[model samples]
Target: MDRRRLLTTAVLGGAAGLVGATALGSLSPEDVWAAEGANAKINPGDPDPNFVEGRVTAVSDAVVFVTSSDGTYHSIRVTTGTSIWKLNPSTLDEVKVGDGLYARGVRMPDNTLAADSLWVNIVNLNAHVDSIGRGHLNLDHHGQRVVAHVEQGRSAAVYNNTPAVSDMSMLQAGKHVKVIGAWHPDTNEITISTVYAAV
Candidate 1:
């Protein structure tokens, strides 16, 4: 794997053989942004060909089967190099049927995605900051109120394309922002991973 994939897989991908989570040195928001950026580069105008977003329907020892929201079937192969993230670093054993999954990897000749990174129950939203509390932010996402909980010491903010920081005091109400988080299935809530906004 390259340095970018290593860092991302190490940070978001669980700590195990191939590239352990400790290899990244820290679970900083930078890694999260970088990983997402990498995936975004796949297709500028078209859909990402190397990404899969769907619900897991079946899991075997080394492969996961998914059915996307559009009913497209995907077969993903998991290897030692694959990194699993479920709110945090996790193992393949943690993957279960019905879990939401977002995977990025190489598309194989056989049509199976050779997954390098897996984010289970992850969510990305564009919303306006409705309110900011001691440990959470209320957002108006597509006219729906969403409660986003901030994880102390884990959540970070990137203001105006600047470096990521833990200081969220700069966030203002009514500002439009992008949020990357882990979703609590079937709820209007999420645990924030990173918040991107303009100062």
Candidate 2:
């Protein structure tokens, strides 16, 4: 057990930067939508009438009915170019009733939302960095290990609450972090979208 402990410690030590740094933010709106299997128009930081938050109530061939948190109802149309994300990249067929959602698109004359992108059950987590590995990192969330895989050129890091950047080197092991990622199909693994930390 002594040798095993020593080896494990060494491995973790090398993996853990044990330095002082941080990271923050998420994928661009267009990139996020594209990951859902479409390249539809999803303008980033635009002040247009193109957003909705609600719970799915019904789904038809290419249309979805939803009830907003305020009790208002909306008809959202999903086109071929419309992107849908549920946990991981997903298809329209996977969208089900009762799933919370956020959609961005244009409004048709009939008042139905022509969705360009839809993200279902997205999660934002606060955790502490446990260890770092090549192209991945281990995070601790309430005592559970959340293995976050780094997507090449996609993971954004923000240190000390500064502007977001694509440099993962800013992330130091053993620091508290905010992770924006998608939960893997049915596992503790997560595909990291962005990470925010304080140095």
- Which candidate comes out best when scored by lDDT? 1
Worst 10 residues of 2 by lDDT: 18-27
Report model 1's TM-score to 2 decimal places: 0.72
For each candidate, what is the lDDT? 0.79, 0.69
Per-residue CA lDDT of candidate 1, range 53-121, in tens? 999999987889999998999998776666677767778898989888988776766788877778888
Query: Which whole-number lDDT from 0 to 100 does residue 164 have in model 1?
Result: 79
- Worst lDDT 10-window in candidate 1: 21-30
Q: 101-140, model 2: which lDDT tens digit per residue?
A: 8887667667777765687766577899999999999999
Clash pairs, model 1 backbone: none
Model 1: residues with Cα > 4 Å off, grouped in runs: 1-49, 108-110
Q: TM-scores for all candidates?
A: 0.72, 0.51
- In candidate 2, stretches whose alpha carbon ends up further than 4 angstroms from where it belongs are 1-60, 64-76, 79-117
